[model samples]
Target chain A: EAGVAQSPRYKIIEKRQSVAFWCNPISGHATLYWYQQILGQGPKLLIQFQNNGVVDDSQLPKDRFSAERLKGVDSTLKIQPAKLEDSAVYLCASSGEGSGNTIYFGEGSWLTVV
Target chain B: SQKIEQNSEALNIQEGKTATLTCNYTNYSPAYLQWYRQDPGRGPVFLLLIRENEKEKRKERLKVTFDTTLKQSLFHITASQPADSATYLCALGLDRGSTLGRLYFGRGTQLTVWP
Candidate 1:
């Protein structure tokens, strides 16, 4: 019954600093996803992992953003040399492998770059 | 490029009235669509899902209608209440034969119900 869990609910960093966010998906969920949500905007997916292997990462900024779900139960998203534009909420979500399964989201990690 | 569009403006309606929100997409076809509710400072919560072949879906007070030809999905809340006020998001599921977990999101439409 527990939902997805994220760490460091709020973060503040200067431009060019590096930030990392951690997420633990719901129990028994095999698919995990990372999404970014800017103010006044909807959440955009950054990457997806299916049991420790990446399913999709086409939208991830390879040069700056990196994510891994080595064991498949949890995930970490890192942003290096963060920019002002990186100020947004980092959301972690998960779902079962079956079709039509509902995706559950965490409380989100809020990042602010000044 | 693929794009999803939702009303950027906030919708204000009476608490007893029905609230209707629109979501439109262009440049790509999805096999299914989903609606989510997002409160301030919280992540999105799934509300409903409707596949391309389906015309309408309902969950309690929530209803969703999808039109593949029009590339549009409509979400309605009947007998709305102040507690139902929040930003609503529409996400496009993967195209047929692709992975089903991936989704693309819109900017979301904010709704406020007044007493």
Candidate 2:
């Protein structure tokens, strides 16, 4: 079966510019997540979507980061007025219903804010 | 909030030897824990999962042991290989109400097996 799919494997933007990453999860998976992984650190969850509804987004910086999973299949994560500190890999992952947290991840979208 | 800790630095060993990694968590005892393998610049791949009730679980040459008393988990790879070199991450599944099954990760342990 095909794994999670992400776009723009790499991205670069100015500090004040905006950037967005897209994701297409595995077929039939109902749970989708976006995580930010900095160098030398584990993936930190930014948001989670169960179907089209948000399950959790406590860690996301609402002032800058926004994500949407329209129709519950495709998701987009956006970072506006990007900061130099926003440079990191944006990883999209998915898990099927009743999978019990066994998430499968995409390769990731690398972002470098200059 | 749960704080998870993995082997803090890189572990290097010769090929054909066994490599063991540790993960410790402070606070509540998770109902289940998971391990993942992440290569440089890539996303993590699911490796294994061990439940609170399960003392040990194995797959091929990989084995995982969970000890609730010590609040730790041990991951072992037998007959290590160069291809096994990567960052290994341990995740705790938070079993709260709306956040049930949410995962929190530890700083991974980098393991390198040289020929």
Q: All models, DockQ values?
A: 0.77, 0.65
Where in model 2 is the C-alpha error above 4 Å?
A: A98-101, B96-100
User: What are the C-alpha RMSDs, in order, of all predicted structures?
Assistant: 1.5, 1.8
State how far residue A32 of model 2 sits from its true place (Å).
0.1
Q: Write the per-residue lDDT of candidate 1 for residues B40-101, one digit (tens) a residue.
A: 98999999989989999999999999999999999999999999999999999875753556
Q: What are the per-residue Cα lDDT tens digits for candidate 1 across A22-83?
A: 99998888889999999988888899998899988999999999999988788999999999
Candidate achieving the largest lDDT:
2
- Per-residue lDDT of A24-80 in model 2, one digit per residue for the tens? 999999889999999888899999999999988999999999999989999999999
The stretch of ten residues in a row with the least summed lDDT in candidate 1 chain A is: A94-103
**Weakest 10 consecutive residues of candidate 2 chain B by summed lDDT:** B94-103
Give the poorly placed runs of model 1, Cα more than 4 Å off: B95-99
Comparing chain B with the reference, what is the TM-score for each candidate?
A: 0.94, 0.93
Q: Is the docking of candidate 1 incorrect, acceptable, medium or high quality?
A: medium
Clashing pairs in 2: none
